[model samples]
Target: MTVNYEKLRRRFYLRLDAVFSVEELNKLRFEYLSSKSGLVRGALAALIQQGVEAEQLSMWTGLLKECNLALARRLEFIRERESNEKLTAEAVDVSYPARPFKVGLKHPLVRVIEDTRKILTSLGLEHVDGPEVEDEYHVFDALNTPAHHPSRQMQDSFYLSEVGKLLRTHTSSVQIRAMEEREPPFYIFSLGKVYRNDWDATHTPMFHQVEVLCVDVDINMSHMRYCVGFFLENLFGCAKMRMRPSYFPFTEPSAEIDIRRQDGKWLEVMGCGMVHPNVLQNVGISPDKYRGFAFGAGLERLAVLRYDIHDLRSLYSNDLRWKVS
Candidate 1:
């Protein structure tokens, strides 16, 4: 039942010397020093349990305790060396040129919508939101679109049911809804995706539009003209605005807004006019007391003009190449 002290110490040193990592050192330490089945610990316990002479037990115990401290110090040294080697291996050079990384950019359409909102907001216009699938009353009746308006026709609209609920064709519906909720002596703007059964090089079934409505006692066509001019100047840095006689069911003197391109081409950008009495009355606002203006412009048209994109469909393709270009 006597412990072989010399043999146990030699075997422990052999195991410790083979450890080259902190994890390996930890395993080695546990094998020899753990209380239950540890080689050194078990040997010491066996010597005491088997009733060794006091002097012999004291000498052996003292020697083993010294060896245990030496083992621990050695393990600590190994741990430090392992850590230093890892640090050296993984060190980064601060002066070295960094690897290039790709960064995502905002979509051109999003940029257009954000810029449009920013410009109108700066002009004291409040931005508002409404539902995409809208009621017929808000989408048409509230906006003074007569029952026969081209936009409401089966060929143009995406009617959901016979009850007259469908995807809004323009942000104008949002403006109408906003007016109904509050009495206005204020300017409001709404921007979001609208839908219709239309598509071509210059059109899409789903597209974005920014709608503006200004309601006040003295709101006039001159105020709307200045607004159109101001918005174009700030948005596209466009100059040379031209307004012509146009018609909308909701406006008294509707004009299709056009901006003069550098190529001397007059590009129609938006529609604006004095709010009609009927549209005002439909929203419970008196026409004589609250005359104002409303304008709506396609965000895709702005993106096309701003980025000089040749095809309107490119904006909706979600193709990285088109966006990057």
Candidate 2:
């Protein structure tokens, strides 16, 4: 048996009117009539014609007019709601708090540096700094990395001028500068921004480095080992550490220090060794008379390893969501 489309449409309208209050029915009817679809228009027209044929023309005409008016009012209500929401959202301010703003605390990176500085100072190391932009001599040659060394390749160093004066590649250069200007039997710590030509999830073109160097007459490899081990234990709050033989131009018997991760794996944290005789000699210190230990590491690497940060870029990205004290 075939169903009559006109009968179905008329029945739908009557059922809607029976189930809904007059106001609700009128609102729904307005939506149906105002719709531009041919199907909706046809359905409405058929319902009206059915109502006329059924001798309810006056009732049907009143309902249709009410539906149309209700639709106009509903549209205005929606427009007003939208305008209010837009205005409220526009007026909202999400910026960092203004000045006299109790000025929020330091960035996580800075906090870590400050804390480390304090820890080192408590251990009798004096804090020092050097220029970010440095000459080739202090950055490379004075550190026992001669001009012919492969580590000075353009791919590794950021040469800033046609003459090759560039950003210091490591904080160790600061150690060199300090030794040149200060008398030793002193403990020194340096932390500051360093630059390289590398960028990746684990590396940035600019980042921070911290180094600790201690020089005196009686200091030896044992002192170097003990100092590094003590610092690592204090910094990480762990006593387990391992050192692997490593290579660095400025340090003799250089070794990379590794700490045990929570996951039972070891990760290299920093490189350290007894300062090479040549490096000391270049800085005008007699290696035979003065021996010291130098250790350096990327600050971000320590943060990443300690805090389980997966991306080095996040530290510098200024993402408020990730910022923490």
Q: Which candidate number has the best lDDT?
A: 1
TM-score, prediction 2: 0.68
Total backbone collisions for each predicted model = 0, 0
Q: Please estimate how well model 2 matches the true structure, expressed as its whole-model Cα lDDT.
A: 0.78
Measured against the true structure, the TM-scores of the candidates, in listed sequence, are 0.69, 0.68
> Could you give candidate 2's per-residue lDDT for residues 1-325 as a string of tens digits?
0144445446545645453244665555545565554334555576675654544444444545655565566556656767888899888466956557344655667766777787788888899998998888888888888778876899988887658688899988888889999887779989999998899999999998999999999888888788888777877788899889989999998999999988999999999998999998998888889999989888888878767789989988888755434
Q: Model 1: how far is 44 from its true place, Å? A: 64
**Each model's C-alpha lDDT?**
0.85, 0.78
